[model samples]
Target: MSEKKEVKDQFIIAYLPDLDNTQTIINNAICFAKMLNKGLILLYISDKAYKCVSITDAEILLKELSSKITGIGFHSYCAIEGQTKDIINKIPHLLSGVLLVSATEDKTNAKVKEKLASNPDIMLKNLYTSRIAYFISSQNLNSNLPFNKVVMTIDNMRESKEKVLWGSYFGRFANSEVIVYYHNYKDEFYRHQLHYNIKFVMRMFDNFKIKYNLHLSSNSKTFVDYQAIDYAKENNADLIICQTTKNKSWFEELFTLKERKVINNSQQVPVLFVNPREDLFILCE
Candidate 1:
């Protein structure tokens, strides 16, 4: 009798909306899975309940694809038949984990993209469950993986710690240097908050012996997210770590524009958006 292999509880979910357009998403997912030493899930969501791909076929395809990868510990496929909203709502309960990877470019129409950009609730409906999401941009379709440099943006908010944690985590796993960029706040209250956040990040990195650089932005007029993205582009950074919108009213969330710009930046640097929550998912070694 043969023994079944045990998979790790922490894994990366790569959502593939179309089988024909799987290369970019799969490549990026494999890169992350290998770098982080986590299992990989090739997930496909289909609205055709009766005509969706069968488990047998999906498994066969998954096996063929997995054969090409070298170091991934475990890999599997999941085909869900449901509306987009229903599937997004059920994902966290079914696959609670540290990270989710999805490509930003889809086959959707222009109107849909515009709507999603303006309304972050619909665009990132899944991350509200406190899942860290990495959205691969189209400009980085062929970029190399195992990021060499990671840029993290900090603001005058408690959520800044989450970005720091993720940036340090990536530095440990991928051996990438982290750039901590903070906005130059002039308000006394905001400046005090930023100081504490920067102090905490410095202490954490110093204790862990992670390689990092601090960059205090002089351009106070520009949005922090845009500044981080610009710095990453100019410095040849492979990834940017930032937080999603938090404590916003319905109107603010509906018109949330920073994340949309960062995700679709012309520089094409990949973004890892960490949602602010009391209980955020942490990756285990």
Candidate 2:
């Protein structure tokens, strides 16, 4: 048998109704679907949710999950598998021929709650369902935006340009102008060197003819982590993109009440953090 190829359909909603805000999930999914001209897949991760349950129970629970969203002339699929996310994950191979509607989520909170601080969720419902259910919607569905601009934030770019190189390929593919922001303190010793680096970065972007923007930071006065957030603000960005590999350790500087104050105050524009292979290895070469 031939392997299935992923579908290229522009927008797809992959929903898990067993999540919180069931009503909101349904509402958002439908709204997004209509807004984006996309298809819907209502998946129930029967056996696949976690490794603890039996298959029989999984199927029963999955079907009873009631993850439904319907609209006139809309293409919707319903599946009660051992695990919903698992099937959704293998969709690239399973639904190979057609285009796929992928759902991406981050384990970290996008906006830190000022009062509650940090604590993990206990319920399966609270953890992933918020966006999973919306994946079924029409409003926040896959983007049709021309992707005319992209941004990058990093500590240093001395040796390896792998991260930027990868980001460039993506921006080039989308035909968007790219901005690379290097966030560091303006120490007296490296003041001159900072200017040179900015010039070099500009040249690299210039060669690509993609039209670039560069930002330099010299001191902790502005906070090292907050410059990108700040630059992203003054520019009024359409999408805030970040790249990382492996898990990032939270820094004391970042987690502190003072630090969170800085980041939390940043713009509310949606952020997109891309996880590329080069992030973990520190392509400082």
Best by TM-score: 1
The residue-by-residue lDDT of candidate 2 on 153-222, one tens digit each, is 5543233243455345435455666667665555754545545556665566667776666655555465
What lDDT is obtained when candidate 2 is compared to the true structure? Answer: 0.40
Give the per-residue lDDT digits (tens) of candidate 1, residues 1-285: 011324346777777654545677788888888888887877766545322465456556656665675667777767666665566545555664457776655323355433231132344553444444545455237755768898888888987787787888777888889999977877999999999999999998888888999999889888898988889989988878988777756665556646767776777777888878765666777
In model 1, the number of clashes is 0
lDDT of 1: 0.70
Q: In order, what lDDT does every prediction score?
A: 0.70, 0.40
Error of 1 at 195 (Å): 0.4
